[model samples]
Target chain A: MSDGAVHCVVVTPEKTELDVRCDSLILPMYDGELGVYPGRAPMVGRLGFGLLKIKSAGKEDVWFVDGGFVQVTREAVQVLTDRVMRRDQIDRTAAEADLQKALEIKPTSPEASALRDRSLAAARAKIRLSSR
Target chain B: MANIRQLDKRRKSVRNIRKITRTMELIATARFKKAMDRAAAATDYTKAITKIVQDLAKSGTDVTHPLLMPHESVKAVDMLVLTANRGLCGGYNGSVVRAALQKRAEIKEQADSGCTSVSGKRGISAFRFANVPVEKTYTEFDDQPSFDAVAKIADELISRYITGRIDRVDVAYTRFVSSSKQIPVVETLLPFSGIEVPQDDSAKGSKIRDDYEFLPSAAGILEEVVPASFRARLFKCFLDAAVSEQIARMVAMKSATENAGDLIKSLSRTFNRARQSKITQEIMEIIGGVEALG
Candidate 1:
């Protein structure tokens, strides 16, 4: 880590996508967005499907992450997710189509409703992030 | 002579086979490199998840989940045998099937009812030949297995274990130790008790517990982390099987190509010697005819 930067790493099942020293990190938690800086308390948080913004040296890098988990230690912030992609990688038309499909899913049972809600949230998050 | 002609034919065929085996060896080499890279990349996730699980276990919270608890008694056993879809990889598939069969026999002796699930056509056919009924057969996976595909199977296994449909889940596969060494073994994946927390040397001298703040709660996070760790373990098995398959193929093809080369060399040598002796005989006959005419 530099003077006030924290080491950040994002790992997917297939590979580690990013490893860098960043000034700050804004991650989407299961409940809301949480920002992290150097010397933050060690914590483990469940991630939601949304944007992950890493700011360093007056520049910002953003990525769209599928639901996973994050661990913040004294030295580094680790993000373990299933899928991570750049905002431009999200096809707006496809995301809109997914949202429509998720809406059409009938919540027949508890499991089915849970699935519907998860997909609905994921599609909405994609659409919201890609449009920015 | 006729013998020379036969030798030439055999040499030509051997040469052609050598070409094919050489090509296969090269392909296996390339594929092995790619598979090894993917396996290495997965190590990070596996290490991270294992650390998290260890921490959760040590966080002073009573960790209890369906996966962490053993069944009342051994009843139904699910043995998942991983093999290759295609054969000709020497004893790669054979050893795996053999190991799996031995495990099944042992499990059957203890469990009341059990079923064997096989991945790869080789294992499926072997089980059929052995008159053992297979509960499930997966032939879609090749050298490259996607995480999503493995996760689907893991999800089914997890649900079965949770609902008490099966008492235990075991996987038999070739563990890739390195490029030169692979061992076929059976491992239990469920019950989630295989993870042994490493003893911290620094904390051994004094009682120091790193204070970790949980987002929701330690138990809640453990609930998610445990299943994720299970999925990761299953995926690692798939990856190891894939990489070992390629390495086995590479070595098998290399030896096959070498054998073909040796066969071709000996055949050509015999062909040359036979042709020379035939020429000498014809010359002698011609010289004798000349002597009689004179």
Candidate 2:
């Protein structure tokens, strides 16, 4: 799989940061993680808030993505997301603070409560990844 | 012949107006630059979202999002009127407002024509005039956009869509195309079918095909993604309009300043000629009297 390189591009609202040929790619989807290679079958998946890892040449790169979508065609791969953060860019202290706030937010009403849990989960993920 | 006193007064008046327009032109230029920077930054965001949306459509998902669902009932429509809080740019506000009014009238006419109803009922009278119930108009901001403002507007639109209060949501704005041309465009905000992705071969070449693993589920992520995308897009639109307005104002002022200069120059020349002629006439009369007395 490493020999058959796959071309991919990752785009955020600010810029098209990565456009390179890669050996393989892994994305965190709503259900689970998915892997793609060159000549892969066409499929689309809902991305979740997690690490998006792409391996190209002999180096691996990781990006913390805030929910977007991924499209795979026969020859190219595209990742479009609102926000993408590199590991170096992620401030551990800020992530921790956000995580703490998310955890402390207790919605008294059922209607407003759903997003709190989601935010908490995201905070935890950020912390866990930052520590690594 | 005009009096010297009157000429002096006219020059002073023109000088004051020149000062005002010159100041305005400078301010408008500065604001226009900032707006352009912001507008450019937002493009990346819009492109990223558009790509995601296209990918979702490509992916065969049973997940039905409310934003995606077309409202079959077309009894009434909601228009979001986005206008500058203050008027200075030539037609920036007026053009957008006019486009909105025209659209409203057209929608009313369609409703009146008695088109076939999707729900098998006389679709509510051809046009129900509903003033854009929600408006987000602002005059000033710090450096960047106020996310809170965008969120407030988004919340209102989302609730309206969810409760079936408005069947469709449309936004009317003046899109900044260039310094000389600001086009008034009306785009659908809700029931998101009008969102377009770049179809050029260059865009196609950039398309990414890969499988993704969702943490919770696709449906859950979409509920958040769609709304966030909408809010981001609206913010971008505001930025675009702001930049366009400032540029328009700057250009308008620059031309006005030039016109003022021309007027002052012409007036001064005329005033000087008239004064000279009056003095010459008095001198000739004095000479004639002296010659007659001699």
Candidate 3:
């Protein structure tokens, strides 16, 4: 921690993506967004696909995360998910192609609809990241 | 001269074989290092997942996750045997198949029947020679096992176990103990007996437990994390098996090259001896002819 900064760690299945000391963080939650500062209450919440804003050491680092879980405690903040990519890694063209395919799903059943919806959300998240 | 020519041919063939084995040994060594790194990289993720499991266990909850409990009654089971796809790996594949067969035999009467699926052709052939019926065989895998591939297999096994189609799921693979030692062992995956974390986790586990608010609910996350952790463990098993396979290949090829060297040496010695005796016999016969004339 850089003089009272909160520790933030982003972990994925393949690797520990990042561990840094950030003054503040804004994480995506299921319904909306979550922002945490130093000395936050220990809480765990389901995550969503959106940008994670980390302000640390007088610099800003951003990452686009796929849904998983985020936990905050007095010690640090931990975000565990399957996919975490930086802004540069997002492929807008691929996401667009996936959206085109996902839109074609007729979704005749509940499961199909949910699958389509998730894919749509994922594609949209990709597009949003790429545009930024 | 004829004998010398024969020996030279044999020596040349042996030398060629030694060259090939030596190259293979070097390749296997390089591959083993890469596999070892991948296996080591996966260790942190595996350990983290284990820590999460431990925390869940300590969270003072009922811990009634579906994955944590074994299904009632011993019905049919599923066993996946992992072996090298290619041969010349010494006893690497042999040990895996042997351990799996032993386990399968031990549970013969207990379970009504079992499905034995093998990864790699070596195990499949071994089972075939033994007249053991293999339910399925996978040969697409190489030294590096893609997580998605292993995950797909693990997911299917887990789902099958959950649906009561299989009461137990066991994996027979070589566990990488160290550079010089690897042991083939059978591990129960379904009915997921708790994870084995590295030693560091045990030491740090004593830290005061954080009061974590449930995300959606603890049960919901448990539903995901439990199986995810199981998947992680299964993937790690594949990684360890890969590293072990490369090590086995390296050692096997090295010994093969050494044997070729020994064979070449002996063959040349015999050729020299044969040539010397032939020359001596010819010279003695000529001298005997001269003495007879005198």
Candidate 4:
């Protein structure tokens, strides 16, 4: 099979996520999952918290990003997220600890509870992505 | 004619003033260099974020974030006005303060015009005037900027936005364009209208087209990303303002130092001439006495 045709850059405050060409891109957005390839129409959408997977050269790269946005055009795809973490960077042990801590917290208000839930979900996502 | 004692006193006072300015110039120079380095270092992060945001904003997403929406109600507005804690740079603080005052007036006018709620009054005004509640004012951050401070400010703004305490948020600061020029700017921080793509002549004729997959949901991701993006952007702005202040101060001090040096040189020359004239007159008087005695 020909080498992966997709090329894109994933950026966050800390560093660049992925700058390599790939066959396909799977991004986590606010609405749902999005798949991208070269020569696609331009679009803008809100991003959500989840794993972004890029497949290229028979290899799959995974990144866990906070909510942001993604823009796709004919030539390149850009993913702008607040936090981008590679699979290796996601410490399963730490994530598990955070998840446990989040569960133990007794929230006093609805907003606090929702925040706790988001924290838990983030930790769970980290653990899940690392394990993969 | 001025007496010797008076001249001596005057000379001493000028000398003291000279010393003070000289010291200030040195301090300003050192601080300026440090600030410039910091400002330069911060650009890396800002540019990176800008590019990413631009790209993401350009991409099509279905989720409509709250920050993106403009609130019609003008019940309250939060203005993040950045000014140098210490004033020496020419128009830096004045320009920023002026902009803030203008904005405050505009808000008040809107309220009076029945464009907004009658009870809608300026809630908080931070900095110089201290008329409004100062959420926070930062002086020196280790000669550069502290990330912790930025994070705290960002958190406050985000919480305020999320809670609807303020209908809108804007940042007024001096955008450091060059050493001699800083433009006071007021930019909207909330409602991620869209990422602003820097103008690049090369990209003028070209277009980007690609398709992507959204994981979980686009709306969910936007909910998280928009706030984070906003916070980062604010932090970057603080860094830029700090750097600009230092640079402006440095240039201003450098010139002051040069001017002071020139004044000192001219004064010294005049003092020497005065001393010489006095000595010559005394010698001539003594010679005249000797001739008259002969």
- lDDT of each candidate versus the true structure: 0.85, 0.66, 0.80, 0.64
lDDT of 2 by residue, B113-162 (tens): 11111100111111122333323333343234454455556656665565
Off by over 4 Å in 2: A1-132, B54-59, B62-64, B108-145, B194-209, B217-220
lDDT of 3 at B8: 83
Query: Which is better, 3 or 4, measured by DockQ?
Result: 3
Native contact fraction (fnat) of model 1: 0.48
Cα lDDT, model 2, residue B227:
71
Query: Which structure among the candidates has the greatest DockQ?
Result: 1
Candidate 1 lDDT over A28-125, as tens digits, reads: 88789999988888888788898899998989999988877888876689998877898899878978997898798677655456557766898898
lDDT (10s digit) by residue, model 1, range B209-249? 55788877877777667677788889889999999999999
What 10-residue stretch in candidate 3 chain A is worst by lDDT?
A106-115
Clash counts for the predictions, in order: 0, 22, 0, 54
Q: Write model 2 residue lDDT over A8-53, tens digit each, in one string.
A: 7776544576788889988887556888877777555567778888
Q: Candidate 3's residue-wise lDDT over B1-294, tens digit each? A: 777888889889999999999999999999999888777766666665555655555565455656667877888888999998999999999889999989989888788657889999899999999999998899988888876677668767765665567888889999988899899999988788765423334566556667777767776666667666777788888888899999999999999999999998999899889889989999999999999999
Ranking by lDDT: 1, 3, 2, 4
Q: Is the docking of candidate 1 incorrect, acceptable, medium or high quality?
A: acceptable
For candidate 4, write residues B1-294 as lDDT tens digits: 376556667667766776776677677778767777665654444564454444444454443566667777867777777777665565666677778667767866664211111000111222324454454455444346654466556756655555556777777777877776778887777755545645443466655343444344444555555566666677667766776777666666667667767766776677778888999999999999999999
Q: Per-prediction DockQ, in order?
A: 0.41, 0.19, 0.33, 0.18
lDDT score of residue B261 within candidate 2: 97
User: Cα deviation in Å at residue B212, candidate 2?
Assistant: 3.7
Query: What TM-score quantifies how close candidate 4 is to the native fold?
Result: 0.64
